[model samples]
Target: METDKQQKDKQQLYTDKFFESGHWLLKIRQVLIATIGWLAVIIPIVITVLAFWASFDPRVPHLWAYHEGIYEIKFIGIILIFAWVMTLIFAVSMTIIQNRKRDRIVEQWPTFNPINQKERKKTIDDFIDKRFGPKEFRENVRSYTVKPEQNLETHQIQELYAKKDLDDVD
Candidate 1:
């Protein structure tokens, strides 16, 4: 009922649709969390620098005597200031890198769902421990279900067989 060219055209359209959706989703996700990676790197480094600097001080009351000039600022102050500046640069670099990476992912695969990258692992792990998790995959293999739709196939197949097999087996 359809020509080869028509089928091919339809297929191409579908392919384009898929790619568009996938990449759109991917871009959305990369934007949301790419900075998270940079933050993870920056937060600990900043915390460490702060904690180390707070360990020592001029004691307080005689602080004015120590604050005479730049010298009172001390070696630790310089190192801390430098460290803080470096941390800022590192954080900015991380953000740029993440943004670039996200852009590339979207350009390459526009329809790739971004949510999968963030939630796939956790969803799978939870499904494994779920009520039906014990039956996930047990044929001498450790298999995790990626989505619930997978179960639909087995259910439909069983239903199809049950009607015939019920009378045939007995």
Candidate 2:
């Protein structure tokens, strides 16, 4: 049997391999997307500020001369608002779909429902007992109290104690 240290080293090796593999590409992609998203937001705000500054220039003949710049800002605002609304709608729809799917799954498998937790636990325990023989109780731990009327004769209790004493002596 492998020692605990060997088992731990094996687990650490697997974890190291998992992170060293293509997972770095996923991390890079996440950072790249986040950077691009922030740039998208920041670049527009900078442009809007510059446009406002240019619109206030006294050298410009008329206020309507910067009308295109104003229109561009308006367009960006509309796009941002539309994107936000679309994202909100997508999130709400996904939540509803997921809830319906979960409900259907729970209906199909009643054991998945929280109300049937005791039944689920009993089923798992039965499976474990069948797969591995019933788990042995710890030798010295008295998890449950044995009542006098439980049908064990005094001699049987004495024999059990005697066996425990012998084990302790060893």
Candidate 3:
């Protein structure tokens, strides 16, 4: 049956694409992690350097890890730089991609059928006919006669009062 197929499709759709914590927030979190991943590398490198020099030289007057060899510092720097570059690239690219997606969603947004004068009149008439039966419907209901310049606030209150009056008459 179609219902069975639809249920199967629903189950498969979850496996096809993972939506976690809303799409935009997930994108934002990805960028944050990527950017902070670099910080994770850089901050430790800096701390290690500071701690190293402070350990040997009392004059340095700081608690810092200093790796003495130039190669070691260069290695850490290289590692930090790599982390920064990878995440920086990911962050910017993900932002642009998510922005495009956001725009697409906005562009494809659905519209609602607005309440208009004709529809409003029909809705009122039909509702009255249903509630009051034919004879009372004919006697009590009148065409909406608000001026075009009237604000929606008064129009809504007028509609509510009209419904209440009809109810009381019934």
- Pitting candidate 1 against candidate 2, the one with the higher TM-score is 2
Better of 1 and 2 by lDDT: 2
State how far residue 139 of model 2 sits from its true place (Å). Answer: 14
| Candidate 3 lDDT over residue span 1-170, tens digit each | 57877877775434312255557866777789999999999997787666666666778757534445645766788999999999999999999999998888856753322334455556666655554456564577785454565435646545654664432222
List runs of model 3 lying over 4 Å from the truth.
1-68, 111-170
RMSD, every candidate, angstroms: 22.4, 17.3, 19.6
Sorting all predicted structures by lDDT, with the top scorer first, yields: 2, 3, 1
TM-score of 3: 0.29
Give the TM-score comparing model 1 with the true structure, all chains together: 0.27
RMSD of 2: 17.3
Q: Name the weakest run of 10 consecutive residues (lDDT summed) in model 2.
A: 161-170
Model 1: weakest 10-residue lDDT segment is 60-69
Per-residue lDDT tens digits of candidate 2, residues 1-170? 99988887874434443356578777787789999999999997776676666677866444343687777777888999999999999999999999999889866765434554565456546554554345675244557555455454556533543543421222
Model-by-model lDDT, in order?
0.58, 0.65, 0.65
TM-score of candidate 2 versus the correct structure, residues matched by position:
0.33
In angstroms, the error of model 2 at 129 is: 1.3
Query: Residue 104 lDDT in model 1?
Result: 89
lDDT tens per residue, model 1, 1-170: 99988887874334443346467776767766878888999986666545445445444233223333335446668899999999999999999999999888867874634544445445545544463445435444565556665454545533543543421223
